[model samples]
Target: MIDLLAPELKIVFCGTAKGTISARTGSFYANPSNRFYRTLHETGLTPERIDPAEFRRLLDYGIGLTDLNQVESGMDRVLNEKHFDLQGFREKMLHFRPRLIAFTSLTAARIFFADRTIRCGLQDRAIGDIPVVALPSTSGANAHWTRDRDHWYQLRALICRAENPSWGEEQKATE
Candidate 1:
C-alpha cells in the first residue's frame, strides 16, 4: 500500500483516486494525456513543466494532492461505494489544515460531500477553515472537459487567491 504522507498541505486538491498512470508512476495526475501539468504551467502556477517525480514542489506553492478513494486505479476501476470517504477524509482535512481544498471534478466533490448541488466553481462551504472549490476534471477520459481552457482559467483564479487572498475579492469587485 502506498501511504500518502500528510505534508503541510496548503491547498489540498482532492480527486477520486490515482489513475493507472499515476499509480504506476507514484505521482498524482501523471498521465501524459492528462492536461494537469500543462494547465498548471499555462496558469503560471509553475515556472516550467513540473516533472512527475518533482510533484513535491507543489508544497512550496502551497498545494497538495489526495483522493477521496485510496483504492482504484481509475474511474472505471472505482465502485460506486468507493467514490467517497467522508469520515476518513475529514480526518485528513483536519490534519492537513489546508487553506483551500479544490476538488478536481464535480463528481469528486459531490461524492465526498454527499451534496449534488455543487456546481463547477468556488463553494461557500469550508472544511474547517479551508475554502472549497470544484474544478472540471482534466482527465483525458473527460472529453467534454479535456484540454478545457476554462479549467486552466479557473485554476488560475484559485492560484491567484492562494498567492494573494484578497485578490479574488478585489478582482470580483472590479469585474
Candidate 2:
C-alpha cells in the first residue's frame, strides 16, 4: 500500500485512486503521460525531474498525495462504495490539518463527498480551516481536459504562493 509519507502534510493532493503505473511503481502520478508531475516541475515546485521512488520530495515542498480509493493496485479494481470512504477521509483530514487540500478531479471530489453540486476550482466550504480546491483531472483518459493550461496555472499559482507566504500576501494586497 502507498501510505502517505507525511501524514501531517501542509498541503495534500487527493486523487481518485492508484493507476496502473502509480500502483506498480509505488508513487503518485507516476505515469509519464500524467501532467501532474510536469505541472509541478514547470511551476518550480521541484528543482528537477523526480524519480517515482522519491515521492517524499513532495512533502518537503509542503505537499502530500493520497487517494480516495485505497486499493493496492489498478484504478479499475476499486469498488463502488467500499473503495471511497468518506468517513475515513474525514478522519484523515481532521488529523492531518493541512492548510490546503486539492482534488485532482471533479469526479473524485464529488464521488468521495457524495456531493454532486460542487463544481470545479475552489470550493466554498472548508474541512475545518483547510481550503479545498478541485481542478480538472490530468489523466490521459480525461480527454476533455487533457491539456488544461488554466488548471495548471491555477495549481502552480497556489503552490507558488503557499511556498512563499510573503509573495501570496503581497499579491493579495496588490489585487
RMSD (Å) per prediction? 3.1, 3.0
- The digit string of per-residue lDDT tens for model 2 on 117-157 reads 87777787767766788878777767767445466567666
- lDDT (tens digit, per residue) of candidate 1 on 31-64: 8888787777787767787877778787777667
lDDT of model number 1: 0.74
TM-score of each: 0.80, 0.81
Against the unseen true structure, what C-alpha lDDT does each candidate score?
0.74, 0.73
Q: Among these predicted structures, which one has the highest lDDT?
A: 1
Cα lDDT for residue 164, model 1?
Answer: 74
